[model samples]
Target: MHSLINRIMPSASGAHLFAVVALAGLFIWFGLMNLAGLTEATVERWLQPHPLAYLVTPYKTWLPYALGAIQLFAGVMIAIYAVPQRWKRVSYGLIGAISIASLSLMFTNPVWIESLGGFPAIGSGQGLIKYVAILGVALWFLGTKGANEIMLIGLILVLGWIGAMKFTGPEAEGVWPLLTGSPVFNWWLTDFGKQMASNIIGVVELITVILLTGHWWNRKAYEVGLLISAATFVVTLSFLLTFPQSWSGGFPNLSGTGHFLLKDAVLLAATFILYRD
Candidate 1:
């Protein structure tokens, strides 16, 4: 196991490079999804209920496209900046754009309180709030050296906590449809039954958490954890394709589940960053 970790762990510079590329990939994919009109309804749903709705209503039709373009441009810039001799001006641009975009969600998304849970309670927002980690990662790539470690710890917390929740009744029920729709996961239902299947998944997630957080103690475990985490995201992301009902009101309009699943993109990126070594 130690030898395997040594083989897989990247050089410090390589890790940073991987983190940048991972983030760029996320931005590009999300941008394309928006430009393709696939996330329009989801955007609208979040925007329409906000206090600034009227201010944004007139531009609603084109806003998503514009944002998509910006994300695409930022992604391209990040990719370009990854080159050794590249000018870092683009990194600055990305920092500004991503910071504004991510921070703006606090006001634009109405479900923040309910999803994130208020104060003492852990709510669905636990997933959404992790965007701050992405923001930190972007900043780290741009210039903040310490941000990488901070973001990694943040990822451990969020993934660990959420993974732990999978053992609880509501979360288990909530994820059932996703599990059932997934070919990779569906067989668990027949073989282990719902409760056992869910517990199995929960165990997988907790193991991932332990491995990720325990990297300092055992790099081998961390590398293995990263593999499991990546695999987990891959399975969850597959839900978007396997379940047509992910989108409602026809192709573009996302149901609650669709919105919930879409956030996996960012989490996927974080996993790469964490495992980049």
Candidate 2:
């Protein structure tokens, strides 16, 4: 098994380089997008319905630009080597902070479809959940001693939370748009009922949770879980190509759904890190 994995997998350094470059690019791209005011309209809308709309409304005009500057700075600082190592760590912390802030918005925005009984049936919440991965990436790159185990734990938490959501009726209905827009997964709805399709996904996700949890006790289970986890991220990220709703306006300007799927790239990167020997 070790021989097979080595033959199939890229070197750890190569994978690490890819993740750093890819995430840096994303940060830069999003920063530029914000600076261009491309997403100003979206931010405007987000502020309006927010619980603290009054306080945010005042800063609405300049907020996007500020966001752009922060993201751009973080991206640039992390991508280049001229800066001190501490600065790179700061950039990673910035990205992680940004991710945490984004996740906090899920509360203001309500991830659980309240109409569908709200606890676990995440609808619009999918957009924010991958922030977990974003945080994981930051931690991973920071090279903290236990960051590898931390990332594994993070993955398990997210997979368990989101996977459990799939079992509920609301989540089954919630994925309708993604499934309908997705060419590969659309068949799941056609071949099996909505609930059943969701159930299948739920079961598989739960199995991964079990497998990954067995990482400490069983090496084989850990490796198998990593493979499955990798496949799961790869497929989800593929939605960018297969789903029409993935993009809006043009390539850089993604729709809400597109943004939701975009974070999977980093999540996939975390899985790569986990595969390291």
Top TM-score: which candidate number?
A: 2
C-alpha RMSD values across all candidates: 4.6, 2.8
In candidate 2, what are the lDDT values of residues 1-277, reduced to their tens digit? 8677655555799778868876887789789889998889877765565677787678889999998999999999988968899998999999989988777777776566787677666777776777777787888788767767767877787788889888888778766666766777886664787888888888998899898887789977887787788788788888888777778876768788777677777776787788883
How far is 40's C-alpha from truth in model 2 (Å)? Answer: 2.8
lDDT of 1 at 233: 63
Clashes of each: 2, 0
Per-residue lDDT tens digits of candidate 1, residues 1-277? 6566546555567666766676676677667778987777767876776676798799999988987887787777778844542444465456546655655665556433344354323454565556666766766656667766766665676667667766666666667777777787776563776667777777877777888776679876777877676667667768888888788765555555665566565556656666663
Q: How many backbone clashes are present in model 2?
A: 0
lDDT of 1: 0.66
* Colliding residue pairs in candidate 2: none
**Which 10-residue window in model 1 sums to the lowest lDDT?**
111-120
Q: Which regions of candidate 1 fall more than 4 Å away from where they truly are?
A: 6-21, 36-40, 48-58, 80-127, 215-224, 245-269
Relative to the true structure, candidate 1 has a C-alpha RMSD (angstroms) of 4.6
